[model samples]
Target: MFARWVQEILRSPLLRPGIRSGHRTSGIFVPVVRGSSAAGKIALLERGIILSSVAYLAFETYKWKKGQTVVHASIKVDDIIEQADYLYGSGETAKLYELLSQYKDSNDAELLWRLARAARDMALVSTTPQDEKKRLIYESFDSAKKALELNELCWAAHKWYSICLSNVGDYEGIKTKIGNAYIVKEHLERAKELNPKDATTIHIIGVWCYMFADLPWYQVKIASALFGTPPSATFEEALEYFLQAEEVDPNFYSKNLLFLGKTYLKLKNKSLALDWLTKAKDFPARTEEDIEAMVYVRYWYI
Candidate 1:
């Protein structure tokens, strides 16, 4: 009777997927007498044990397959990152944003930071209403903050976080905006320390210096009142950072060229200013930023 019960269980449709022919099965065996009145109860208990064993094996197999799938997915992430980088290099900001936005909830710090950058870029170039533009900027800031939380050591996270934080200040009051300057400077410096060769990070530091150096008298007083010794830098300091960024990656960004020109103008060096402004004007207008750079050159320097 026990042998007949075992054969019936092995042929059951419910267990077919997990238990195939020639698959070894092992479990605790409870012996039973052939003519005993308790045979039915023993058989039921035996059946329960078999079902439990099959369920356990199925769960283990599922776990193994799930792990394999995770490994494959991680490899695909690298390919996606490469594709995103190519889009960015071509100044395809819209395409880059579309691709990375799908992974906004991803746990990867690298992808999150890149997404933040794309969102911020879109916000900068967006022709949408003010409320929509503000939404995008805040979204960018959230993504950057999330990336930083995931990996404090990620330099790109620090860089984007600083940029997004500064962008958010536009909607915030001037007092909050001015207060965030020191925080922005700290993150930019941290980013520079992590990756000194990044031209964009260096360029942004120069922008910070230029902004404070050119602050009007009333704003200067506000800053000084708010934070004792307010942040200050000279045109000479801003010029040095811009030049260093250029040295690291010449013509990498049109804004850098425009700023170099602006800094020279502040220093009363018209010859150098004109040289840099002309370069900015001639830069290919592949994206909105490049177009804006050209417009600035024409308006202020031409």
Candidate 2:
């Protein structure tokens, strides 16, 4: 209430003209009215001081209120993220995608990254035609790119950018796909550097290494013909990343466990492969990936 009153005084049109009329400057002066007494001048000075104090207090109060508003907004954003995460974790991919898509134009980096990831996962699990799947993947890439533009320090943005980039790579020609593969690795590495303890990022780096290592000879030949020998990796490299991911967050994602098991099998460690595969098989088949992991485990162990 007091703030509004002071603001009214500061913004009042009549107050400004009256104050300006009494002012004296270096190069110009306005003489006092003929019959104005010294006491009147003193009273005018006191009023000016009071007005100044009130204006200062009002400005400070406005700043405090603005700060409180920001804090509340931040809390609201956190709540939204928590709800989205629960939906995504519970395998409600379509709903999660729709929920986050409403915030496509949001400037918040965390929200943008989550939206990108939701889009990418939706594309992965979608049984739609190739064109629609590709469109969703591209949307994921664009959202991740926007998140990075908004905040370069957002590790999740880099992580999802790498994932969406790889998804888009599936449609590219061999040469272009190989180039995108390198870029995918670079982003994954950056994400790992920024968030070394992020199990998902670590698992993705392992997947990146595994995909390139497991590429068919024909694809490699095509890439080599188009570009001077493309980069190559080994199952050993993949195993290291997967192991690191497990160390950080053991069995967090069934897919991560499946990858660890598959990498171990590829590396000729049947015992370790069996151990990880069994864990993946027993992991509650909650999400699509978990169900897929169960199928793979049956195919391998049964």
Strongest candidate by TM-score: 1
Model 1: per-residue Cα lDDT over 1-302, one tens digit each: 54454445545576444321121111110000011112232454454345443332322232224333222233356656655555554445566677777678989998898888777666654345677668877998999999999999998899888878877877787777777878888998998999888887888788788878888899889878988888788889889999998888778777888889999999999999999999999986543445556766776569
lDDT of each: 0.68, 0.65
**Tens-digit per-residue lDDT, 10-127, candidate 2:** 4556544322111100010000111112233345445434544333232223223433311222335555665565554344566667667767888999999898877766665435
* Best model per lDDT: 1
Clashes of each: 0, 0
Consecutive 10-residue window with the lowest summed lDDT within model 1: 24-33
Candidate 2: deviation at residue 215, Å?
2.3
lDDT of 2 at 149: 92
